[model samples]
Target: MTDQPAIELNNGVRIPQLGFGTFQVDSDETQRIVETALEAGYRHIDTAAGYYNEDGVGAALKASGLARDDVFLTTKLRNGDQGHDSALAAFEASRKALDVDVVDLYLIHWPTPTRWLAPETWRAFEKLLADGAVRAIGVSNFLPHHLGRLLETAGVTPAVNQFEIHPTHQQPAVQDASRAAGIAVEAYAPIGKGEDLSEEAVEAIAQAHDVSPAQVVIRWHLQQGRIVIPKSATPERIRSNIDVFGFELTTGQLDALTGLERANRLFPNPDEFEASQFRD
Candidate 1:
């Protein structure tokens, strides 16, 4: 049995605190890799339309033989597909691609604020939740200001706010804002995509715990009460990623990891980023 705990969202949906992510996992390899993650005891899987691997994720889910409700699946609307009508259409396409009648959580992939489309797109997500097409709705890469703007007229408070969070990018303001708004925080790139795993503090914690640095980081996220999704296609790492429930970090170690934060962000600022930059 999986030892991962679940955190309740504002909408009362409980999501696994630790999950498997399929960000850069190629579409061709997603099926086998995702299946491996499931076999390794990951009950939650994070995917997105822009990842271009929903079909493969769907195939793995079908092949896993687990009941549909046994897994918590999350997918996002592509940044290129914003606005009310396009967002609705994109959700339909993603639903078909994932072969699911209703996804557990659906998210706006990015605010793309330059397009001024997040509020419009969020309206579409609200409709999906109301229609029972999705169990929960949230946004990714959104900061407090973005959320503040959306909340002014939003019919529903977002259940979660997912963003790039790691030891090097703690985002205290965002975390505080989300907590004030009663939105759960979900951390993507929880280990900074293997960037800071070798750092002195992380390694020191790893050594003390007799675990890998990645595990220490994952545990750190958990200790902070944020949901974390760490991705890996390799079988060994995939299994080891889910083994974090066995250890707990000391308060001093947790503080050390917190001290590693330099507010370093690896992605474009949502307020300034445009979806067109990703196009050929």
Candidate 2:
């Protein structure tokens, strides 16, 4: 219901370009923190089953009195649940935990390429879409090669491909591939885990714009037409993260940020990562 900018999905569904990410937000504190974000005008909330906070997300949404349609909610299937039937069952568990009959978006938390089950997982995603359980479907931390394989048998091209992108980790090849495949590229760690913000280029731009380094970085993402999910549990930070629509980064500044790319990746490589490691 807000005039906030959004991008149309491949299926014609409009998704708010900016979202609040609850990646490491503690489940015990998720309700209060999420309520603050909701009150700060963030309509999009992204949580994964692995985050263990979907119930809190549901509580906050219910307590806010916003209609189910007023907010856009996204949750992902965990890595342990990657097979065909298991993926479908995992989605239902997420839906129940979130207390929502329909999820705005659903994603595979990771490609888990070592398991060799991404294609099969995607098949279940297609079924969820067909059954009207999820408005849109996507994948997180997938590289171009993983997507190339999925495309071979995919009935529906992924609506979005979320990655660990920032001024430092540009991932141009993956971004370009997503664009070419008609999939929206989403920046997961858009601020570069607080490392790139201290760079000379980001600092100079922030001083010129009279905003924080994080805001300048976020603004850069918006200008480039990438969906950004910046996570913060503090009330002030949560509010500041979504208050980025007012400014624009200059072309020179944008290029300067782009030049900061050094192929610095912060998270685990999807191909080598497995869910069992986290479980134990």
Candidate 3:
């Protein structure tokens, strides 16, 4: 119950402007951490099947005693499960793990061009959307070329394109392509892995606002109208991460952060990522 603004997706579903992420959260500790996030006013949560913590997220939601409609939940398909039937089955597994009848947003975890199975996997995603299993469907880690190829056979344009976006690694081309197609842009690792928070530009802005560098970076994403998800295992950091609505950044500060971009992409190339990340 916070004053977070909601962004409407291409399909009319609204999502929180900021969210808590469970990327590296261990399943053994996810429930406690997520419950902490919930208590800190994070109404949006992002998880993935590959993260192996949906059950914990579901446990946290149930433990919080919040109504189903009170939160927006998102999860992603595992890279290995990239086919019509496999993807559909994977969704069922994720749904059951999360204990949700309908997922707010379901994303194909990666483009996995090497697999040559994304188009087929997207068919399953369309089926899920049509069948009302998910409120919206999208993809993550996709670049412009990936989106272009998927668009060739996709009947439903993705509602969102989430990727690693930070002060240092802004993907302008992908952002342009996604927005051009009416898809919302979501940022992961918004504060960057390590070096971003310590940068002079970010630190100077933080000093001006009297906030943490992470908060300043998060604010930069929010002020730009982009959805941001920042993850933390610490309670103080988790609460502090969402307390970014108290102040704003000036145009000069925002431009300074934008000027920090050096194409420092931190993730693997989607095209070269093998479809089967893990084997049975």
After superposition on all C-alphas, the RMSD of every candidate to the true structure, in Å, is 1.3, 1.1, 1.1
lDDT of 1 by residue, 1-280 (tens): 2567999999899999999999999999999999999999999999999898999999999999999999999999888888899989989999999999999999888877766687888889899999999999998889899999989878999998999999999899999998899999999989997998989999988998899999999999999999999999899999998898888988999999999998788877877777642336
Q: How close is candidate 3 to the true structure, as a TM-score?
A: 0.98
lDDT of each: 0.91, 0.91, 0.93
Q: Cα deviation of 5 in candidate 2 (Å)?
A: 0.4
> For residues 172-252, could you state the per-residue lDDT of candidate 3 as single tens digits?
998999999999999998988857999999999989999999999999999998999999999999999999988999999
CA error at residue 270 for candidate 2, angstroms: 1.7
Looking at candidate 1, the ten consecutive residues that score lowest on lDDT are 271-280
Worst 10 residues of 2 by lDDT: 271-280
Q: Show pairs that collide, candidate 1.
A: none
| Alpha-carbon deviation at 253 in model 2, angstroms | 0.8
Question: Model 2, range 72-143, lDDT digits (tens) per residue?
Answer: 999998988898999999999899999999999999888888787888899999999999999999988888
Q: What is the model-wide C-alpha lDDT for candidate 1?
A: 0.91
